[model samples]
Target: MTASPEPTDAIAIPDSPLAVLQQVFGYQSFRDGQQEIIEEVVAGRDALVIKPTGGGKSICYQIPALLRPGLTVVVSPLISLMKDQVDTLVANGVAAVYINSALSREEMLRHFAGLRRGEIKLVYVSPERLLQHEFMERLGELELGLFAIDEAHCISQWGHDFRPEYAALGRLKQWFPRIPVMALTATADEATRQDMLSRLSLTDPLIHIASFDRPNIRYTLVEKFKGIDQLLRYVAEQPGQCGIVYCSSRKRVEEVAERLLSRGHRAASYHAGLPLELRQSVQERFIRDDLDIVVATVAFGMGIDKPNVRYVVHYDIPKNIESYYQETGRGGRDGLPAEALLLYDPGDVGRVRRLLENSDNEQQLQVELYKLNVMAAFAESLTCRRQVLLNYFGEYQREPCGNCDICLDPPKRYDGTEDAQKALSCVYRVGQHFGVMYVVEVLRGAATQRIREHGHDKLSTYGIGKDKSQEHWVSVIRQLIHSGLLTQNITRNMVLQLTEAARPVLRGEVRLELAEPRLVRVKQKDKGEAVLSRAEDRALFKELRQLRKQLAEEADVPPYVVFSDATLTELARYRPKTESELLGINGVGMRKLERFGAAFLALLRRQE
Candidate 1:
């Protein structure tokens, strides 16, 4: 949050975007659809891009800024994102500055003067600033190159993290009809994309929807049993690494963070309830590699640009797929291998329901509940996890992605038509007035006082499902709800109700295939067998990591900015002994090579 602008001499106008890519960002080639998206925006046209995290989205608009004549105004949603992006650009020797509430008025005037003089190539501002009348009038006077809206999903009402302020950004397009507007996001579904198109008023735009796949990330989901024990086991398994544990509430965040700290991990808690200065401080420490883990709510990860987060553990299930995807996407941003696991329990659905009950908008409420059911289906699926996730986003990948738990060990599903019929018949017999637990008891023929009082014991559907245990029946109930043969009434304590699709299952018109329940009544091992540690080149890897920390501390930057753990891992394995050998490493650019390459090479020689 410095008040000073990045120093610059004359601008280096690149002949093409490719020149800027190599010289500034240090990439030999554009990733996925970046080349096409950049070509469209650089040629003065509107574009909408949906590239996955770590897919080099920033470069698409950044290269165009280098090639264009005037300052590119980037509308970023987070102050942390603005700061990190500007820091990286300035570190790369590009003149970039950010103006937000974090800056003083004097600093804002100075940066605006720099922009007026065309000294700054990129200017990062927030949605609030863009909506101001004075700012727009002043902006209209300048020759702006383009408008880059990072986290463009915020423009959509259906987006997981929507901002009312972003709805005002559509006026930016109308104010400067000639300046191209590029809306970019890493997370958005079909609804969100359409909303962005309509809100930004992008006409006949070049929409590049890149594949939403992170092949390097391994996905795993386990039922919650002794969850904190399991978390400890996983954390111990991955030694000297960074990860995040996402809880559903601020209280849970504090409890988990405390538990981890008591176990001797450098952990912290983050949520909306924390002081703003404390939250900002924790984020800074995490980014600087000063902490190993941060237990947080969903509010913590939106502005995180750290590349070495090795894993993300969802202590409870997220409300919807969009939120889950964005939170987990925070891992493996360096294009290195990462791990993600969600410890799910049916009890979490009750929490989700309670949260949704408070929302006043009936239309949005229904939409959110439906999305929650879809997310529950993903967590419960016995087939490919990636398949169900991608399908929800309107991308169909027929073949199973072999990177997830289900793909590795698929569950054997049994023909469940008779069982489903029985469940649906019971729901109908019970008058659709009770929730899952009571219904399960009815199926198991529990002679509870409520059942006796309602005369449910005399019903023909009673004791029909006695052969299956209560846990198995509960799992079946969840699956039935997910399969659309049943719906949960949100207003009436989430009572079980039948939708039109339930008729087929009840009438034997459709057959259901359900995964055999594997409910572990007894506690399993304390530590899971989901091993993620890859201590490559042990001896030199240790030295390289220590050196990286030293350099990061000196430069007051993240260790990743000095050289990510992945790059350091490569250095240790290859043991680059010369300048040329160091140059061949994946993340060693000219600036890095000049700064620390010789020192690393000297260490390799000493080791030899």
Candidate 2:
């Protein structure tokens, strides 16, 4: 609940003052790249911190903000985020204020006046506000310490959430030459990272990249022919669990949320088109646990601080792996077991393909699209899902997770050496101008009119794979594309070509492991039978919920505004008998305890 000790001597140099690292920010130690990145920023160097979400990125800037002599200006993207951050800072006894567009003219003037008088340590502003002439003029007058760009990936066109305003951040360095700048993003691929540096005009910034692995999250991809029914079943099984279901379309979000609500789940929909106040209210309710599930599009989550989200379900496949990684990273922030589920179909791939084709940079977009197609292939892959996911980020795992579907019910591997050779041969024979469907047809010896006209049936390889269905061969090609044995060229022509790794397989020198495609069928389980026996736990949970409701009523706030279901679950499980014990709950800060501790304690004592 308290701020960790700061590292004072982490950046101490001979020319700099000799001080212990723990004396400054009240933190006793440094995380993986905190000390190094902090030193770089303090020594007036530009840097990019690519730490994972909840990976102590704040310390990189908070420490530098305290160490430097002037005010640190942070350009955030959301109003609610700025408020939450500023509130936390004030609670921690630090001076922080924000100037968002939500404020009235008078309110804005007062906050600007506070900034000018040097009464604030940090000032959070949206990019649109910072672009204002009056705000820019005021910013020029202030002695700025560090210009921090949160969610820096937005600056890159290749990133998921691209903002035009972020591209304009280069002007900051031009205006304030001596001030140090640090850019931070929770997720960025190699392409995105390079684009951030180039777009921001950072001068050889020191790059600190933490590991992308979220070991606490259990990744699962379920094929859903009846997606809505399956989704309802899953949600019912995890009753009262806080989770997010991402839909590609706003309509899908509405439909999914409505379906969940009809099925007796506390669910809500959030999209860009929603009313501003309604969106804010929905977000607040979800954070407070008045809502158990939030069905949203890409618009909903950026800088969300809810820590105990137990699951994240992707209703549609994302456009790229970076977006998928960042979205799913929202789960398991508290280092507890969490799940990432994706219910996808092959048609989703075509939709994503069209989206990529419409993008401005076709080549970069194509590469990213291929990456997504690889993810789709991964969803259907018989190998450990974790292995394929980690492989995309340029990391590898030798052994299976032993927890994923493939590991639990081991897939039977067949000798695909001949099949691999035939698939690769078809690519060479077809002149590499055809798509996967065409390639599969050619290999399966299907004597269609087009194939006969092209004289493809005359080839020796024709009819060789007739023993397999077209779908089977298509799955083979997909797995090959994902395994790095084949590459899909999106432009010039959408065709499959063999990569270098496929050479050995084609020559029969190496055998490839291939799993037979199984028809995924979701068995209907009785909802009552599926529910775990948490009778005592549920009784305590209800008591805690009632206590929370009382506190919210007294405070005139929503019940969730008091505490999250996860927090209440913790209280029930731990049975925090004392105030000190209650303080250890994730969302129970000093202010919350001071406001509602007695009511909760009274209920706990009565239950005991």
Q: Please name the candidate that would achieve the greatest TM-score relative to the true structure.
A: 1
Per-residue lDDT of candidate 1, residues 55-99 (tens digit): 778898988888877879999987767877887788788889898
Task: Tell me each candidate's TM-score.
Answer: 0.69, 0.69
Query: What digit string (tens of lDDT, one per residue) describes model 2 on residues 1-608?
Result: 11211211233212221132354335567768788888788888989998877787877886677668788999899876676676656655566777776676776677777778876668889988887888889888988899999989888866766788888987888888888889999877666788899888888789888887787888876655568977998988898899999999999999999999898898999998887678878887888889889999975766777898999999988876777888888888898988888886777898878877887875567666766766676766766776666655545454567656567665657887777788888987887677888888888878799989888888777778888787778878876765667666543455777767777887778767777664322222443112224787679888888878877888899998898776776666556655545665667777787788888878776766
Worst 10 residues of 2 by lDDT: 1-10
lDDT scores of the candidates, listed in order: 0.81, 0.76
RMSD in Å for model 1: 17.4
